[model samples]
Target: MRKFNLVFYFSGGGQFACEIEAEDMATAGSIAESLELRLSGCKGYDLYVKKEDK
Candidate 1:
């Protein structure tokens, strides 16, 4: 398993961070997108995942 960091900024000009566990970075991105969709007060957001050396 690997850990990924998702960094994004919402429509209201607020930055947010999310961490997720998955077999790969692609999976982590999917998980982050799902989580983002369910949040309130988020008109839009930039999706991204960062890979770590660990």
Candidate 2:
């Protein structure tokens, strides 16, 4: 499995924030899903996952 760094930017006005680190996209998606429920009410919450470079 590949490692990835997931970044979630909450729209509004704030610095870039890292959300989670996962083994793969699937895991990252799950993490994001959980976050979405918890973070509900905040506008423009977006999730992004990118593989870590070796």
Q: Candidate 2, residues 1-54: lDDT per residue as tens digits? A: 544454444556543456466776777778766776676354434556554568
Clashes of each: 0, 0
Q: Candidate 1 has which clashing residue pairs, if any?
A: none
lDDT of 2 at 43: 44
Error of 1 at 16 (Å): 1.3
Could you say which candidate leads in TM-score? Answer: 1
Candidate 1 per-residue lDDT, tens place, 1-54, comes to 876666666666787777767887677767767877887656544444455666
Off by over 4 Å in 1: 43-54
Clash list (residue pairs), candidate 2: none
Which runs of model 2 end up more than 4 angstroms from their true locations? 1-16, 51-54
lDDT score, residue 54, model 2? 80
- The per-residue C-alpha lDDT of model 1 at residue 29 equals 69
